[model samples]
Target: MAHKVFISYKKEDLQFKNQLVSLFNQNKVDVIDKSLNDIIPSDNLDYVMQVLRRDYLSDSTVTIFLIGEHSSEREGNDFQGRPHQAFIKKELQATLFDRENNSRSGLLGVVLPNMYDKVYQGTSICSTCGGTHNIVAIDDSTVIKEFSANYYIKPHNKCAYTEDDRYAVLVKWDEFYSSPEVFIDQAFDKRKEPVANRVTVYPK
Candidate 1:
């Protein structure tokens, strides 16, 4: 049977998500489209969770967070200085604790193109981090920025929630485009295994 995969992504990458959906359909991948972008925004988080559990993530076997630029940005959770109200948190929690068959859906992440880097006060954007900064870049000549934007910040802040979520720290993400199917398969297979929070693209 085909797995019903719920695709999660930032609204900024709508085009990429559509193209990815097309490819999945072309390949006849057994993933059902259960994305929640059809209607107006929910009134509150409770309403949102109600709708998701009752409909959006219904019967989903896996969730593929289509990582993109600003995917991990916590703007949604920043409602009037409220952090716990983050929509992504609700989504992730729903995937693991939705009112379903009491089984957590497998978690898989596709580190899509345009996955961005985060900038903090003591750090500067890497020169090779492509053009444009997603967030405000600071002038920090005193403190040395540990992570240079290469493939280092590729996954964004995936492990922000759990110390160990998925994805081995050493996996070559550059190969994802060439072997997407293989990557998905591997990720799905190991979804249940324990994983460590990846600090760098090239694990130290």
Candidate 2:
């Protein structure tokens, strides 16, 4: 059977969404476009997750998280003079387990090449909106392992949520941008393959 993919990303990544829709159109892949509503408050974490599983994620078997610069960002806690929210966590946590209505879906992360910014020697900042990216990428295996572990571990601080590696298939910005079908296929078919060896490309 063909893969049923659900794309995930911050709403600001419109161009990335367009690219995905366009690619799927040309290649005849299936994309389910159900995103979280904006009006929902971060304080309603329970409702947010409930709606996510029941409404947005119940139909798909894989989630394609377009890992942009700010994909790891989170809402400030309520005590910080704001409502507590963990939308990033909600999207990611969806990948680890099955919704009551759907089977557990795998995750695929396609990094945005444009989100990479060059700051200094051997160091390029990969973040959204000109901010610094604080996530670590020690090596392919380390990166993959860290991601695998973090998906199951939830921290107290919402602002510190940068564990996008739940995506077993991690695609480089250009590699995915140029030829998405190849990697999308990899995500769907090679379920147990060692994604640890997949090339880790950082954009500048």
Candidate 3:
């Protein structure tokens, strides 16, 4: 089956969302961003929360939260003081709905590439609980592994999550294609691959 990915973003991030949607579509991943307009209504915060807690959370195989300046300022949050709330909060809550929801599927974060200044300057608060901001990376296997072990191990919890190796393989494709030589040189141990005795990409 084709991979299912849900994209959560703010209205102000329409352009970025569209770009991601198109990229994933081109790469053959089924995107849930199609409900962009229908999912987030201007006047109905309840509707948005309901859909996330129920519909989107139930069906999506994975979630991709696109972080921007205003993503967490939505109304569902109690307005503690932060600039943005985290989508993971909803994901964890909804993922625990059923006792048997053991599938710890993919969870990814995409930060605005150029918005590091605001993030680093600590100018904004988390729109949800008014906590400090944290940026999680897609390639962090350690975090993913620990989270998976916690959720998927004995006495399984509701917020169980995992990063499939196949997903990592797909992610690595970008690195491989960008600089095949660099990837081969760095990833493979010289002793294990025995490059001196084998064919090398570099000039002999």
Candidate 4:
């Protein structure tokens, strides 16, 4: 089935975003692009967010977040006077918000090449489980932390988070670009899957 997808990414990652979209086109993948192309034109954050939620994100079935090195950097302050990557955060929040007309989108995190080393290091032996586990560096930003920290349910082993445990499926750029549909389908399935119940759309 052709799924309408919205891409959420920092401006710096536009190149990769273009490449991703192009890959979909070249491969004849069944994906409908719902990403915002033009700027909102208004400086009023609230108004801009309203337009984003109502216009762009309302119909998207999945939101693919491009996680780069600067993706987690807090740039400006929101209405509450707290620092944040206002646009990205708001976009993700809107994607996660379910309403009468709009359902919560399935979330997918794509780690860019620049962040590959930082996010995924070599495997290491887990002290808790005595099993080799992927050494992942996830403390890049509060945005990532807020969304991904809920992957595992409470009282679960930190060293044993399988793909099924994650509310937001994450993949490296190359891996995703190789077979985009596979991951995209996985994300779209989350909408009606049990994992969707564990998702926290709004940040604390």
* lDDT of model 3 at position 104: 30
TM-score quality measure for candidate 4: 0.84
lDDT of 1: 0.47
Candidate 3 per-residue lDDT, tens place, 1-204, comes to: 455666656677778778766776666657676443465654444456456646665565555555555543233444754223333333433322232343333434345655444333433455655665434332222222222222233332323223221121112223333433332222222212222122211111
lDDT of 2 at 29: 76
Model 4 pairs whose backbones collide: none
How do the candidates rank by lDDT, highest first? 4, 2, 1, 3
Candidate 3 vs. true structure, TM-score: 0.44
lDDT of 4 at 141: 51
Tens-place lDDT per residue, model 2, 47-165, is: 78667766766776667776565554332344655322245556656554533455556667766665444111143454444555455342222222223343323332343334333
Q: Which candidate number maximizes lDDT?
A: 4
The predicted structure with the larger lDDT, 2 or 3, is 2
Badly placed stretches (over 4 Å) of model 1 are 32-34, 37-40, 73-85, 98-102, 116-174, 191-204
List the pairs of residues colliding in candidate 3: 72-84, 72-85, 82-125, 82-126, 83-125, 84-126, 84-127, 85-127
Query: TM-score for every candidate vs. truth?
Result: 0.56, 0.60, 0.44, 0.84
lDDT of each: 0.47, 0.55, 0.41, 0.73
The order by descending TM-score is 4, 2, 1, 3
Runs in model 2 with CA error above 4 Å? 38-43, 73-85, 99-101, 115-167, 190-204
The 10 consecutive residues of candidate 2 with the worst lDDT sum are 195-204
Q: Judged by TM-score, which candidate is best? A: 4
